[model samples]
Target: MTRTALVVRGGWDGHQPIEATDLFLPFLRDSGFEVTIEDSPEVYRDAERLAATDLILQSVTMSEISAEALTGLRAAVAAGTGLAGWHGGIADSYRNSSDYLQLVGGQFATHPSTHPDARHGEASDNFLDYTVEITDLGRTHEITRDIADFTLHTEQYWVLHDDLIDVLATTTHPVQPYHPWHRPIVSPAVWTRLWGEGRIFVATPGHSPEVLQDDNVRTIVERGLLWAARSE
Candidate 1:
């Protein structure tokens, strides 16, 4: 059977929701999913339309979702549909809804100023190289299959997570000159969770367009979407 996917994207323009989603379309097509792109969050409330979808790719961030819409989404996932997203698109989305947070499993706490010492520049200017370490390899899941340890020059996420996630990869930020308020912190960059009969996958990287274009990052995300959609 041909799988169907709904790409719901909208919210803060800073993350380039539509643009980032464009990069993943061909991947979804190549995987044999008939992709439908929606620019608004209203689609979440259309229960009839959502029921026909096999997977939902949401790129919305920091937006308020109506309780009715949020309810429909949770129902779809619980009935075995898949939900996947990256960075703030998934983790930082629908901040007002605890139901949404419980489903996604984590939240973006902060990206401590990268350049705390730059007297004349923005703290973001201090952003530097960071690597995500792979942990809990025993699962040997397809999402991380053959994926070797890799590093990326991106804003490593310091997420606040609950124990429901099956963490796949992590990254560490040693106390640096730019960020002295905290000690060494290890953060989960990739993780998956079982939500009722559905599956959910989230990756904390993809802060920049270039990072999302990386071959490794792209592959893992592609496989993750499929893995999350499968009914086990």
Candidate 2:
């Protein structure tokens, strides 16, 4: 049977939800997903719509979801509908919504930058380099299996996460000018977890379509979506 995959894209344009989600469309289609795209999270209120979904790719950034909408979403995931997202879309989204944070297994606190860019004169200039080391768990996980370590020049997500999450890939952050904290913070760059029978996948790398277009991000996210769909 053809699986149903919902792609909801909207929120802060800085994350370019439309463009970023667009990069994953062909993959979803090629993988046998009957794709549905929505520009708002309000679509979650349609109980019948969500009940028919197999997987959901939420690309909204810091947008607030209504209590009713969030209730529908949380119920669907817990009842075996898969959820997947990246960056601020899934991680940094709805800061005030503690339930959403718990559901995703993390909250984006900040993206610490170690770079000293006196030229730009702002902290945003500090988006520096980072390496994502695929973990042993990743080597065995269906989504990232056979993939090697990768690097990205984007925001290194410093998230407040649940320890029970199955960490797939990680990046070590060092103390720097912008990040005055002493100690190398080990952060999860990719992870997967179970919410009831549902699977959740998150990759904190897509800052733009260019970033999502990276060969590694593209391949991993594609497989990740397939894995979330339980298509294998």
Candidate 3:
């Protein structure tokens, strides 16, 4: 049977929700999923619609979801619907909702400036050359297997997460001479969490359409969407 995948996108135009999500349409179709698109999180209010959905791909960054809509989304996922997203689309969305943060198992704290002396107003301030290191579990996990450590010159997310998540890959933020921190900080770059019978997959590397199209990032996200979907 064909699976149903819902794509909810809108918020923070800086992330280019439409263009980013568009990159994956062909893959979803090729994977035999009947795709549906909603421009707002208001669609989450339709509990019945969410119930029938096998997977949800959210791309809304820094947006708000009403209490009713948030409740419905949690219920759908708790009842076994899968959830998947990348970058701020999932990790940094709905900052005001603590419930949403707990459900996703992580939150974007900040992306440290690349250079201590760099100006804050420009985009390049947060863009840094970093490496995503696949963990031992990632080497064997379906979502990251055979994917070697890779490097990217982009925004590397520094997330605040809990032990509930199973980390697949990580990126480290080094301590610059100008920063106050003494130790290097490591953050999860890719991860999955189990909530009830549902599955959630999050990747923090897709800061733009170009980053999402990277071979490693694209492959992992493709596999993650399939892995998170409800069982047939």
Winning model by lDDT: 3
lDDT of 3 by residue, 25-96 (tens): 899999999999999988989988998999999999998999999999999999999999999999999999
The TM-score values for the models, in the order shown, are 0.93, 0.94, 0.98
Q: CA lDDT of each candidate?
A: 0.83, 0.85, 0.95
Q: Estimate, for each residue in 75-191, the C-alpha lDDT of model 2 and write its tens digit.
A: 888878889988888988877788888889977888875445443665456476889899998999888888899888877888778986899998888776565688889888888
| RMSD, every candidate, angstroms | 2.0, 1.7, 0.9
lDDT of 2 at 216: 87
**Which lDDT tens digits does candidate 1 get at residues 134-177?**
78561387898778778886667889899999889888878876
Better of 1 and 2 by TM-score: 2
Runs in model 2 with CA error above 4 Å? Answer: 114-116, 119-124, 230-232
TM-score of 1: 0.93
Clash pairs (backbone) in predicted model 1: none
lDDT of the structure predicted as candidate 2: 0.85
User: Which 10-residue span in candidate 3 carries the lowest summed lDDT?
Assistant: 112-121
Shift of residue 20 alpha carbon in model 1, Å: 0.7
